[model samples]
Target chain A: MTVAVDIKNRLGDFSLEARFESAGRLTALFGPSGSGKTSLVNLIGGLLRPDQGRIAAEGRVFVDTQAGVFVPKHKRRIGYVFQEPRLFPHLNVRSNLSYGRWFTPKGERHDDMGRVVELLGIGHLLDRRPSHLSGGEKQRVAIGRALLASPRLLLMDEPLAALDDARKAEIMPYIERLRDETKTPIVYVTHSIAEVARLASDVVVMAGGKVAAHGPTAEIMQRLDLLSEEEIGEGGSVVDMTVSAHDESFGMSVLHSAAGEVRVSGLGTPVGASVRVRIRARDVIIATERPRGLSALNILSGKIASISSGNGTLADVLIDCSGQIILARITRQSCHALALEPGKPVFAVVKTVSFDRANTMSGVKPG
Target chain B: MEWLDLSPEEWNAVRLSIKVATWAMVASLPPGLLIALLLARGKFWGKSIVNGIVHLPLILPPVVTGYLLLLTFGRRGPAGAFLAEHFGIVFSFRWTGAALACAIMGFPLMVRAIRLSIEAVDRRLEAAAGTLGANPIWVFLTITLPLTLPGVIAGMILSFAKAMGEFGATITFVSNIPGETQTLPSAIYTFTQVPGGDAGALRLTLVSIVISMAALIASEALSRRLGRRMDLE
Candidate 1:
């Protein structure tokens, strides 16, 4: 299913004009606070009426101002999960789940309750009241409630913003499962780049109430020129790899990336289990030749593809190793001393321990 | 035992009071809830003016409110004449007129209770329900109304008790006709006017106090039960 939205709305002095389309299973609206990400989602969900625009989801017209046709939020068949759970306090968990079903016309109900409950791991909490559940459990139930509504699309507005880091990690897997298993298109909104990296199949970058860029997750993450200079300084690429082998003698596990095999200091995964690793540009170092006696465990030979000038005294070097792309940020002085240029053969060095294990995920096989 | 021995007149007054208060609550609940929702949730021009109009009876002297009702709902008044001509309905000098005055006097309290509760309800929850495929009316009935039930019950009891004790308005608008327009308060007023009727008046006063206290206790218990069920505790 595809969601196409081009809407312009004015709320006092703040004007929102955005146009973007996504066929990805989960498209993230990523921006900073006051960047109008939530406003854009509200327009798509039919919660806010736009002054002029057209919105279509799965080939169905939700809002077309030129035609003077505006479908109400309920008929749009879009489920919304807010930062707060917003569960009906008067109803028990079971009744809250069934509330959406009550409004679903008999012939349109498609989602299975048992599977949803199992998927969200809320089976035991079915009879409990919302007040009795923890923050994470409430969000999970909220997700399940939205899913049971059999919506055409789901909108999650900073679902993890209110939770602690542990709670966020707790709910991330359930959201990933939802993204992978459900056919419904989801528009997830967040200001956290890490959340977008881990959850979004496509990323729509927003700035100053405008769509700055939109593309597949990996490509957008790698585009230093399109991203804000500040983000490029801190942002990097994510690679999905798998544990190829574990060496007990070396105290490391061999991970196979698209570029080449990478040996990292981790041993939790069995062989052939997929893992996602994020490599920030600032963490990478480039050497003109293979340096001996280096403590860094990763050294891949690659040709420099491009060099980008940043706002400060730094430059971002894009290295193309085989088919995979890696970014390195270095001072202009380093570039001058190393003579780094396009097509120059260099070794991208990454310290084994430098890989952030917190952002790493294992046991997910590549699709 | 002596208090239990009510003469036929006292029995008619008690029954009439029940009938008037019940009818008044039933008749006013729908409008009260509608006004409460509008005032609590709606954004419109002249909203404050509308709010004030709904609350005028509460602030005005009960006798003045009754006088205004009599002028507007009398046989020749615009609304009263139209209803009388179209539906053969009459309010002045009748039991229904007593109910009308009591409802008017009790309306602001009912609306205030319901409005406060409605305002207290989270609008985001209603928006979430809307996104879950519930139309506006369905959301109100299934979510809004049920969530605000404690307030609705409180409003009903408050209005019922107010109607039960309504004196100035009922007497001024519908007059104290013995079995027709005379409610408990009006009957007590009539009994106190005579030299030998002090005992009867004291008895009715005690009954009125008992009924008001009972209504208050019932409302409190009901609200508490609902709060527990909703996990508001």
Candidate 2:
């Protein structure tokens, strides 16, 4: 599925001029706060009318101002999950989940209520009122409600922003399941680099109400310059890996990828499952020679591809390991001390495996 | 038992007051909800003017409101003449005329209560409903209306109580007539004008208090029940 958007909207002093087409199943609109990410998703969902330009998804025109074509939100067949749950307080979980089905024509409805309820693991909550639910449960119900509508495209505007970290962790796996299992294309909006690394197949970088960059997740993730000052620390390389085996003796799991095998402690996922891992550049240490007494377990030998220095004492080195690129950030003094340059052989020592919920995602294997 | 005794005329007055108030509340409900929705959500020009006219009966003297009603709804008045000729409906010096007067006098209270509740509704929920594929009308009916039911009940009770206590407007628009347009308040007023009528007026006065108190309690219980159902409490 392809989502095509070229729209210009002026809200007060902030004028958004964004144009991009993403064919990834899950495309992330990634930016910091006040960057018009939410506004871009709103334009796609038909909640806001654009002053100019056209928007089409899967070859169906949703809005074309010059052509006088504007499908209302209800007829747009697009689902939206807002920052807040926004569930109807007066309706129970069952009714809220089925609300959109009442408006969809009988012949066009494709989602089954039972399947949606099970998909979100909200079957037990069908009778409870929205007010009685916790933050995570409410978001799950909201997702189920939108899915039951069988929208052609889904727009998520910071679905996890309102939740605490524990709640966000609880909802992330379900979202990953949705991205992998559902047929609907999703345009997710978030100000979090960690979320984009874990959840998005493609990323659209927004800055000052414009599309600063757009590319595949791996390519866009390496461009640390595209991140803001605060998010620069979180920028890293994303690698798709599969769980190869379980080291039950040490209670660890081994992940196999093009970059080679890496063992992570405290992983609970079953073997043969696909997982995406993000290795932050700040967490890597480069060794001129392969050290023998090092406590760190992950080490990959590769020739240095390139290096870019940031404004601080740190410089990012790109390592092309078996055709898979891994980024490492080190100080310029170390670079000079080691005489590191392009085509120089070196060892990249991974300090720690980020098994944190924010950096790891399951169930999306590279095709 | 002896002091509680109500003569036939007093009973007729009590019964007539109940009937008139019920009719007033019922007949004005649809229009009250409509106008409340308009005032709360519609973005048309002259909104403030429409709001001022709806509230005219509240601020104007009851006697003035009654006079205006008589001028418009009397047999010789243009609206009255058109209705009487086209639909054979008349509101001149009759019990139905008393109901019309009470409804007009109570309209502002009902609309105000409903409008406040409508305004309190979280518009985000409505927008969410729209994204869920509910059209505007469906969103209002399923989400907006259910959420505002407590206010609707409060408005209905306010209208009923106002209609029950109405005196100046009803008496001026439809002159008091025994066994016809004479409401409880009108009967009480008539008793105050005559000698040896204190006992009868005292009896009707107690009944009026009981009805009004009952309405207040019922409204409270109903809104609380609705609140609990919505998990809003």
Candidate 3:
């Protein structure tokens, strides 16, 4: 376990009560805005005190309300990267990265400045002041600064909310590299399901300041009953696959998965590279039999395991393709017209492929 | 250098003005910073009262302020009598008294400049530093102080300029004594009062204008340079 939190707090009309344990190196606090995602991480980072409950990271107790123990933020040894970069304007890039190192006890210091600079690709930015850097560049320096402090846990509150699409694309790999290189656990807060799908190993879904669901990233994503339609948009299934082939002419890549080989629009990875493909339930079409001459590029056959539709307009059809589970979002009329039922055989037609833009991107795996 | 002509007495007055202003600026800096921090961050009882008292000299007439200072710090007053007896220091009828009066009159301007700057600092930056294992004192020194440097500089220069031009308070508290308490402004006042004193008065007046302009320009350039380096407006 990396971080464990159980706390309750109230602010005017909003009441926050949450309890969850994170085992993954990169655990995500997944929720919509005002769901207490930031507040939860803030409590973990010691920026906000909990009215009651205990918080511990790596077995060290940060707060214990019953015991009347409260630790201030400075002693918590947590690194927080805010939505804004919040870099010291007076200091240059190198100095900002080392600002926290000066406060860390020597024994706990992580003095791999060379590697941090290299990891973030900020070699040429050391001498430049923060005002001179772009938004994306400032965020990179902020992350590096937090890492250099040797924090026991790193909390990032929508660290990329300020960056544009191109800049977000530019920085995602560095974040991946950071996760791979550092041993410190990360608690990332984000509302974007794409970010949670690609970056998180575990997901904690929050709604209205409460933990709606918590589990492995794959399990949580596939839990149709536990997620709203907004959260389930094109993210119903996360297929773990490796890059099997790439077609430069068509700008496509093929990914090999347990269910089947999936072909999509772009494969940014080399051959034999792993990628996570998010298959939205809505993008899946159900067929009683495999159809021919269809424009859909990929189809997987499986047995219908369950059919759940709380409302008549929409319902989720769970299909077990080989050993992997996939979801199909279909209307009640089609479900009734197709006479869909559990244990029945069917085919899942994926209209398109979506890819998580990381090392594991399957070319055009359904978005 | 033809415009720089000055007699020995005028030169002494110019030097004394610089000395008194320097002393006033230096003596008020620490307290100004402290009060600014308090007004920016403190949550205590009677904070408004403290604020009012700090700005009293700014709103009061210079002579009235000087009279209040005399009432509290005269030779026979509680603070003045104790200091003279124990530390052998005197404030009444001396150059130090002029410096003291000037500092009092200029205190509010310094504190107000610094307080506004401190308030402008982002508290979130300090919180970020705290998360990085920086204690409160460390955060203040590394983040708050450096970020507010422009304001501090502005405050110091303002106080210094005010001290240099101070006349009413200095005259009332210390009297216009040549070679002692007669600063540039006081000496100019004295020169304008007697027959055939026009040349002397003009010389000191020109000197005063040059020094004041130089101080203003120097401060503007210094703060601008520092603001550029720190990326502050």
Candidate 4:
């Protein structure tokens, strides 16, 4: 296991009990604001001690209550990127970035300042103070500072939460690069499902101070019942589709998966790159038969795997196209009119415009 | 020019006052910082009582504080006797005793300024440092202390100015011995008591104003420079 945590802690009237193990390169702690996700990250980072539990990363035990062992955060070698990019105001960017390097044991150090600066694109900001940098630039410098420490486990607590949409867009690609290129394991915290779908390979869904579900990103995302009410509309199937061809004339790209070809807006990456696409259940429309000449461009024939209805107003239909699963939410009247049921042949149609840049995460170069 | 020029006796008091104030300011810094940090960040059973005791000199009459210092540090006193016997130190009517009294009198102001600054420091930055492998002491040295530079300078100046003008406490704790413990304030008091000493008192009063104004201006410039360096301004 890359990271393992079984902990119980209490703060005032709120208590948290979490247990999960993940070996994924980027594991997301997904939850709403008050769901104790940050507290869990703090526990893993050794910032908060658990009243009872054991936490280990990379086969080294950080805290084991039974054994009476609790390592301090400084010795645990965990890098944390907080929500506010807490940079030392008195130090220049160069000094702040190198601050951790001085404390890391020389023999154990692996992070090269040159490589980290290049990775985060913060070379021009070395001489600037923290107050001089913009929000996006500060966050990038913060990431570089943490990476320079050469931590064994990197913990990010909503690193982009304080940024606007434009800034979030700017910083996300660097985080993806860090996930893909770095050797260290990362545990990211976020309440945004879009962020989880874009970056996380594994997810631990938290609710009401407990682990509601924990599994691979794709599997956990499709379980709409596990999502909060606000997130239910956004929850759906996440599919990794390889870029097989790009229709330059039409300004569209064809993504091939096991299910079928999906055409979205023109992508920036070259052909053969793997991109993750989120098909929101609310955006999907289920049909009894293959519709002819509809405005919706993408349609995949599948069999209805399951139908679940809550409160008798709407229903969620799960369709299996070849071996890939797709989710569609429709009204109960339409569900009953079409006589949808398990093992029934159907087609799941989605409009090309429904898949915007926010729904598509590209930049994973195929290995 | 003849009347403005200070006599040798007046010069001695001015020199002695500067030495005592400088010594008092320098000697109290380390303890002042430690105590400020403790009061700002520590959580203990008698924290309020510690805070109260630290502020006692500020609230209590200067004479009472000076008398208390005399009673504790005097040669016949228990602490005074032990220190005198063991360490060959003396506090009665000595310049060092005046410095000790000034340091005590100025301590509350120093600690208050430093404590407020320490409390204003963003603890999140410290926690971030901890996660990056900086131990607690390293965090204080690199993050906490550097960020609190302006306040530290302010506290030092406050303590220095308080020591420079210190009269009641110094006089009571250590008597006005002209070449030993007669600081500027004591010297001025002496000039004011005599019949033909008006010119000496006026000259020394002008000197005191200049010194106080210089200390304040120096502190303002220093803190502003630090603020600019930290981008806090």
- For DockQ, the strongest prediction is 1
lDDT of 4 by residue, A1-367 (tens): 9999999999999899999999999999999999999999999888899999999999999999999999999999989999998999998999999988998999978989999998888899999999999999999999999999999989999999999998988888888888888898899999998898889999999998999999999899888888889888888888888889999999988889998988887877678887888898888998887899797889998899999998868898999999999988899999999999999999999853233244334455322
Candidate 1 lDDT, A135-234, residue by residue in tens: 9999999999999999888899999999999899888888877887778889999988778778888999888889989998877877666556566654
- Give the TM-score ranking, best first: 4, 2, 3, 1
What CAPRI-style quality would you assign to candidate 4? Answer: medium
For A1-367, candidate 3 gives per-residue lDDT tens digits of: 8989999999789899999998897899988899999999999998889999999998899999999988999998898999999999888999999989888899988648998888788899999999999999999999999999989888999998889998888877777766656888899999888888888889999999999999888888887666555666746888788889998999988888899988887755788877878888888999999989999989999999999888558888899999788888889889999999999999999986666564443222211
Q: Report every candidate's CA lDDT.
A: 0.87, 0.89, 0.88, 0.90
Give iRMSD, candidate 4.
1.5
Count clashes in each candidate, considering only residues at least 3 apart in sequence or on different chains.
0, 0, 12, 0
Worst 10 residues of 3 chain A by lDDT: A358-367
lDDT of candidate 1 over B148-226, digit per residue (tens):
9999999999899999999998899989999999999999999889898988998888888888898889889999999
Candidate 2 residue spans exceeding 4 A from truth: A310-312, A358-367
> TM-score (0 to 1) of chain B, per candidate?
0.96, 0.98, 0.96, 0.98
Model 3 root-mean-square deviation: 2.8
- By DockQ, the candidates rank as 1, 4, 3, 2
lDDT leaderboard ranking: 4, 2, 3, 1
TM-score of each: 0.94, 0.96, 0.95, 0.96
Poorest stretch of ten by lDDT in candidate 2 chain A: A358-367
lDDT of model 2 at position A190: 92
